[model samples]
Target: MMPKITTNRRKWKADLMNRVQTVDDNDRPATDYTFKRVTYFKPLGVTAQEKALSVQEKAEVVKRINIVMDHTINTKDFGIRIGEQLYNIERIWTDDEKREMELSLSYVD
Candidate 1:
């Protein structure tokens, strides 16, 4: 078995958000989501390239982060929020022992 995950390594905190749409009594459209606490690592900086006007241009940098936590079945249909920025779940991987999981997330508009 692998070594236990130490809490000291997890330095950042993030929230998992699920998008929910509803209608108020007035029939106005509303959209929002709830947040759940999760531990995440620091984001890694990355530059994005976009094709603009038939030319390859450097777009804004998009940071990607990894969230590591105990095994859980509800990883899908959720987005991660760090501070004022929000990141969409890209992928998920679990350890061989199935004791932990790591979620790959990227920034989204």
Candidate 2:
């Protein structure tokens, strides 16, 4: 057998045909009826380089560097392969290079 209507069709039908009362005279146009261009901003990839660290940031940097340096030296003493690579990287890092890196590190990190 066909099922009885479970929904109220009259209430739903009346909603779409409801009359709207105008605030202004029907002849005068709305001043702010400007159609703003629908802006479709593409999915923004909010990726960017890290900013330079300030003195507060530098403190964290120094702490990390010291710990890393100690780890590298200890690894070298133990004859680990990475110890040499770490040391080599250390050699390549001059004071000027470090300062520059410190400035840029915040952004990268």
Candidate 3:
């Protein structure tokens, strides 16, 4: 199904990042890592789901977002960052026409 234009409002801005391996002064790979910002996108929509057993329960939070089709994103090397929270791309689905892509993301925490 095509995304509804009205519902697909570009309200949220997110950063597309590529994981980068750090190197030590001697040029050896370091244990630490960083991310390089690939691009910024204003998502068509942002949906957040939080499941909890009780009012005080801390549950897993998942975020789903839709954006215009971008060829630069690959699940193996990229991630999405919204605000201060970083998420791993769990799955990616593209529309039949390749006009849009839906990303299922899981919170890093």
What lDDT does the true structure give each of the candidates? Answer: 0.57, 0.20, 0.64
Writing each residue's lDDT as its tens digit, candidate 1 over 14-105 gives: 77787566798899986566676566665553323311311332223244554455554353567777887776665555665634566555
| Residue 95 miss distance in model 2 (angstroms) | 39
User: Against the true structure, whose TM-score is highest?
Assistant: 3
TM-scores, each model vs. reference: 0.53, 0.13, 0.59
lDDT of 2 by residue, 1-109 (tens): 9989844221211000112223567675422222212211111111222112334344222111211112122211121111112111111122442221111111111
Error of 2 at 74 (Å): 56
**Per-residue lDDT for 104 in model 1?**
52
Q: Can you give the lDDT of residue 65 in candidate 1?
A: 52
Best prediction by lDDT = 3
- Candidate order by decreasing TM-score: 3, 1, 2
Which lDDT tens digits does candidate 3 get at residues 2-52? 875664455667878776667889999844225665443444333333233
* Evaluation by TM-score, superior candidate among 1 and 3: 3
Off by over 4 Å in 2: 1-35, 50-109
Candidate 3 lDDT (Cα, 0 to 1): 0.64
How many clashes show up per model?
0, 3, 0
lDDT value for model 1: 0.57
- Report the poorest 10 consecutive residues by lDDT, candidate 1: 50-59
